[model samples]
Target: MGDDQDIGYAVTAEFYDLLQAETDRRQARRRFAEPAARARQAILDVGAGTGIVTGILLTASAVPVHAVEPSAPMRAALLTRLAALGADQRARVTLHPEPIEETGLVRAVDLAIASNVVATLPPPVRRATWQAVARALTPGGVLLFDPPPETLPGGRETAARLGPVRVGPDLYSAELTLEPERGILRSVFTYRVERDGVLQREEREAFDLWPVEPALLRAELEAAGLHVVQAPHADLVAARRTAS
Candidate 1:
């Protein structure tokens, strides 16, 4: 039942997929597809923004997918995407308009994924989410997620430009500021829409994220009854439920 007030995804939802097109494409191929294909039973897609990963999971396998998204706009986009899929794929998905901490999964899942979602949560919320995920997973079930790098600068500083990404007529520019003491990383994104080489509209959105160290995250997961394992990918962390 988490609201979108703090996350700011509602403001960015319209342009999110377009803004992160390249990164999403690469991750769909390199990260999501394989793990989804390996799922034998149910799979839970946490923070299923715009259904990018949810669509990938649907196409990769026939396993029932529970897609949890907290942002209303993002969930709307996800439902639209689901409607466009084949009937069989659509039938295999269940959309949950709630955060992972309140997943309300009917049954335990064999695999759960939360790409780029962990760092966005505050510390207490993050811990509660991990515990909830553990409870939703079957014993030995796998969980995969990517946390931000531990080296992220910690300090109050003016916004620093990250870079610009473009997809056709849409352009997105990113800037970041860090408040290390609070474990919050704030990112500001500016989206510009242009058609026929004329400026149309520009929008700005911001998000706050908390980055935890690998060791700290590992300890947290272990305390939640999960066995943490470093995945082959540097940014990815894979954990398995060790107890029922």
Candidate 2:
């Protein structure tokens, strides 16, 4: 979502929204809605790709949001979506075009959400991110992200593939081939957009993803002054800022 991982997202960002099901989006909305409602100060969205999850946070609560997105294309799309919001909502969002470290951080945020961006974070970046998240959050502030299930290294032929969404006259598909090497999941994403049973456009891009150990992740957060807590949902990992 930032300078560390934009290379793989270039091609994928175009068809990102298309690949997600309506049910998936709705479920995601419901999952974060509670924290958004409870947030009094503000919410932070790290790697806010195309603002799908960010929009959910905005609509779920009447509070300001810090949308940190480093990918230009995705950020542009995010800006496009934010442009359609009512003036009040529009005024509440501050777009950070850089990584969390380089941005003007707010230390009183009530919640921070990182959707699909967590597992892909390299160890070095993840450490920096956890430290930054700790610094930005208010006491008892919440941080929720995916409990990324580890994937074994595999070739495209044997890798897990998802999508092939039908969109009126066209169809979209994405294949994720993971190569976990050098402490990163080198993901080769193959995207194919076709129409009327004809292959139209195909793109392949490599995304670097780093594995996360829950125990280690917990230790890291604790070191950063945050505590892993019971998640609102069974699928997410929730951490709260311990009172200083």
Q: Once superposed on the true structure, which residue ranges of model 2 sit more than 4 Å away at CA? A: 1-8, 21-24, 150-163, 166-168
| lDDT (10s digit) by residue, model 2, range 25-77 | 68768789888988899999988878888888899988999999888878888
lDDT of all the models against the reference?
A: 0.77, 0.81
Assess the local accuracy of residue 5 in candidate 2 as a C-alpha lDDT between 0 and 100: 53
Q: TM-score for each prediction?
A: 0.86, 0.90
Residue pairs with backbone overlap in model 2: 185-209
lDDT score, candidate 2, position 176: 74
